[model samples]
Target: MKVLIPSFYLILFLLISNCSTNETVIEDVTEIESVYFPTVDGTNWETKSINSLNWNESQLQPLLDYLEEKNTKGFIVLHDGKIVIENYFNNHDIESNWYWASAGKTLTTAISGIAQHENLININNKVSDYLGTGWTSASIEKEQLITCENLLSMTTGLDDSIGDSVLPENLQYVTDAGERWAYHNVYVKMQDVITQASNQSWSNYFNTKLRDRIGMTGAWIPFSDLSVYWSNTRSMARFGLLMSANGKWETSQIIPENFINEATSTSQDINRAYGYLWWLNGKNTYHLPQSQLEFNGELIPNAPSDMFAALGKNDQKTYIVPSKKLVIVRMGEAADNSNFALSTFDNDLWEKINLLID
Candidate 1:
C-alpha cells in the first residue's frame, strides 16, 4: 500500500508539471509580435514573400484567379506594411493609372485634416466662411448653418436627387443642415472651400500637404464637375499603408493623429458605419449611398471587424485593417451592377481574402 501511494503521488506530480509547462509555451507563442512597419524613403518600398509569412500559397493563386475573373485591373495586399501580394489583370501593370472614383473622398478628407492642422482651414467653421454667402441655392440663413463638418459627414441637408455636380444650382437645400444625411455633390464644393480658404489651387494644396510628402503620384482630373483622383495601383497601396500607420510616413507625421482617429470613427449619429468619408466595419448600423434605408450590421461583414475602407464606383477600394496590420487596394470595373460605393463585391472580395489568409 505504501509503494502504491508513492506511485500515485509521482503520477500527480508529473501531470502538474506538464500542465504548467504547456501554459508557459502558450504564453510565449502569443507574445511574438505580428506587425512590421516598413522603411519609407522618397519612392523605395520593402516587400515580403507569402512563404515568409506562412500564408497559404495554394489559396493565394485561387484568389488571384478570382480577381482576374471578376475583371480586376489591379490588386494589392500589404501585410505588416510590406507588399505580400500584388497582381494585375487585363493587361494592366504597376505603371497603369486607375481612377479612384468616390474612393478619392477619403483623400479629400485626409487633405482637409492636413489643412486644418496648418490652421489654414477649420472643419467646424461655416462653409460660407470660405465660399461666401450665395454659394448655394439655399437662403443665406440656411446656408450659414452648413459647416465643413456637415459636408464631410454627408449631412449637408442638400437635395441629392439632382445630378452629382458641384454647380451652385445643384446644391439646393432640402432640409436644414444637421437635420438630414444625404450623399451628394456638396462634397466637391469642399474642394472649392479648401482652395479659397488656403489661397492655393486644389491640386497644389493636396500635393503640397499630402501627396508629395508621402511620395504618392496622382492627379485630380475634372470629370463632370467632380475632381476624381487617378494614380497607379501602387500609389493607392502606399496611401493605404500610410493610413494603416496612423497617418504617418516612416518617422514623420503626415496627418494629425487626432484627425486620423476621428476620420476612422463614426462621424455622425445617422450613419454608425461612416467616418468622415471612410466606411467603417463592425458597426451596429450603416447607411448606403443614394438610399435612406438603414442596414443592421457591419459594412463589410467578411472583413476584419476593425477594417475601414475607401470605396468607389465600380468596386475601386482601399481597405485599412489595423488589427491585422493589413492594407488592401483594388482597382477594377464593377464587380456587380450595384451602387456607386458599397456593394456585394466588398464582402465577396473580403471573403476570398479571409480564405487566403486562413
Candidate 2:
C-alpha cells in the first residue's frame, strides 16, 4: 500500500478548504453594532472603566454595600453606553430630585409613542375619542369600549380599586374592555389622552415630544391623584439612556423604532408582564397590582432576560437590558418591602445585581 500526496501538497489541501469555507461565510454575514447614543448636551455622558471591563473590582465594595443597605438614593449602572457605576446613598448626591412614582408610566409610554409618530395620536383610537363621551362611568356602550389600547394595556376593564382618580366617579366598570388585568390610576388618564389628542399641553406634550428632544430634564409635578415625574438621578440616567438606545438620540429617531418596539414588547394578553407602560422581563407569565394573581415566572427573576423596567412607587427604577447593554438606575426611599410597582425588593435588587454582573 503506497501513500502519494505532494503535488505541492495537492494545492495546499484545496487552499485550506477554501479558507475554512470563507470563514463561515464571513461569520454568517456579521451585524451586531448599533448601541452608543449619548449626546443629550447637558453633560456629555461617556465614562467606562471597570478596569476596562475585566471588571471584578472586588465586585465594587459589595455593590456599594448593597446599595447602602437598600435605602439607596441614587445608583446607576449603564454599560455599553458608558458609565460603569454611580452611587449616592443616604445623604444623596448627584443633584437629587427623584420621584418617578409609577416610573412615570414609562415616560408616558414614550410620550405616547411620540404622539403616534406625529400624526398626533391614535393608540387604536376611542378613549371616547380624546376625552369626550362622559369619560368613564362605563355605560355609553361601556364607554365606547375604552381604547388608547385599553389605556396602554392595563386592559381597561377599569377598577383597580378606584384609587388614582380619573374622576368620572373613579372610572368604574371592572370587566369589559379587554376582560381583566389591573394596574390602575387609569394610567393617569393617558395624560388627558395626550392632552386631548395633541392640542399640546401635557407639560407641552412632554416638553416638545419627549423632554426637549432628549435632553430630558423632567417635570410633571402635581402628585396626589397622580402626576409625578421629577428628575435628577442624571435625569433618570437620561431616561435609561433613551430606552437603552432603541428610542435613539445619537442618530435622532427619538422614540419610534416601531414605537420603542411596541413600547417594550408584549402590550397585552392579560399581562404577559406588560408593555406599552413597559415592565416586561422574559415573560412567561406575570400580573400584579392589586393582584388577581398569576405570577408564573420571569418578571425580574434576577434580571437580564432582556430586562425591561420602569418600576416605581418607592422602588423607582429604570433598567433597560438589551442583552446586557444594560441601563439601570435606582432612586431613593422605600425598598424594605415597597409596593405599587413591585417589590420583594425586586428579587432582592436582582440578587445584588447578580453579585455584581455574575
Candidate 3:
C-alpha cells in the first residue's frame, strides 16, 4: 500500500508538470505569431500558403480568374502582414508601377498626421494660416473659416463644380467650411501646407518622413494641376500593411496611433463612410464623389464590416480590414465601366473574397 501511494503521487506530479509545460508552450507560440514585417532594404517578402492557413483553397483560383477577367493588373492579399496571394495579370508583373489616382489622397492624410505629430502643422488651424490669405477665391471672411481638418474631411465647402483643380481661382467658396461635405481637389492643397510648414518640398518631406521609413518606393508625379502618386503593387501593399498595423512599421510609430484611429473613423457627419481621405465600409449610409446624394447602405455589403479602404480611380484599391488582419491591394484598370472610386465592382469582388476567407 505504501508503494502504491508514492506511485500515485508521482503520477500526479507528472500530470501537473506536463500541463504547466503545455501552458508555457502555448504562450510562447502566441507571442511568436505576431504580425510579420518585411525587411525594409530588400525585395524579400514572406509568403503564406493557402493550405497552411486552412482557407478555402478551392475558391482562390476563381478569385484570380475573376480578377483577370476584370482587367486587373495586380492583386495581393496579406494576412497578418504576410503575403497570402500575389498575382499579376494583363502584361503586368511585380516590377510594374501604376498610378494611385485618388487613393494617393490617403498618403496626404498620413503625411498630414505625421506633420501634426511633429508639431509642424495643426489640422484645426485655418487653411490660410499655412497657405496665406487669398489661397481660395472665397471672400476672406468665408475662406477664413476653412480649416485644414475641413480639407481632410472633404468639408472644405469649396465648389467642386469648378472641376478638379486646386488653383486659387478654382477654389471658389460654396458655403461655410464644415457645413457640408464635398469631395473636391482642395484636399491636395494640404500637401502645399505640409511643404510650407516643413520648409521642404512635398516629395522630399514625404520620402524622408514616410516613404523611406516604410521602405516604399513611389513618386508623386504632377499630372496637370493634380499631384498623383505612383508605385509598384508591393509598395502599395506595404503602405496598407503599415496602416493595418496602426501607422507602425515594425517598432517605429511612423504615424501616431491616435491619428490613425481618427483617420479611419468617420471624420464628418455628412458622409458616414468617409474618413480623412479614406473610404470606410459597414456604415449605415455613404456619400460618393461629385454627388451630394446620400445612399442608404453599407459601402461594400460583402466586405467585412471593419474594412476601410484607399480607393482610387481606375480601380486602385488598398483595403485594410483590422478584424481579419488583412491588407489587400488591387491596382489595375477599372473593373467595370465606372470610373469613380466606389463602383459595382467592389461589391462583386468582395463576393469572391468572402468565399475564400469565410
Model 3 C-alpha lDDT per residue in residues 1-358, reported as the tens digit of each score: 1222356786686678787745422121123368899999856799999888888999999999999999999999999999999999999999899999999999999999999999999999998999889998999999999999999999988898977878889999888999898988889989999999999999999999999998899799989898899999999999999999999999999999999999999999999999999999999999998899999999999999999999999789999999989999999999988576988999999999989988
Candidate 1 overall lDDT versus native: 0.86
Runs in model 1 lying further than 4 Å from the true structure:
1-43
How many steric clashes does model 1 contain? 0
Give the TM-score of each candidate: 0.89, 0.35, 0.92
Candidate 2 or 1, higher TM-score: 1
- Model 1's C-alpha root-mean-square deviation from the true structure amounts to 7.5
Residue ranges of candidate 3 with Cα displaced over 4 Å:
1-32
Which one is best on lDDT? 3
The most accurate candidate by TM-score is: 3
All candidates: CA RMSD (Å):
7.5, 18.7, 5.3
lDDT of 2 by residue, 1-358 (tens): 3345666876786678687846422122234656665676676777888787776688689878877898988998888778888889899888778888888888888888888888877888888888889878878998798888778888889787857777888888878888887888787777888898877678987887778787768688886767788988888888788888788787777788888888788877878888888888888889888989898988878787888888888788888888778888899888686678888887777887777677
Give the poorly placed runs of model 2, Cα more than 4 Å off: 1-43, 52-105, 110-130, 134-141, 144-153, 157-179, 182-192, 201-204, 213-237, 241-276, 280-295, 300-356
Q: 220-294 in candidate 1: lDDT tens per residue?
A: 998887889999998898889888988887678899999999999998889899889999999999988888999
Write down the lDDT that model 3 would get: 0.91
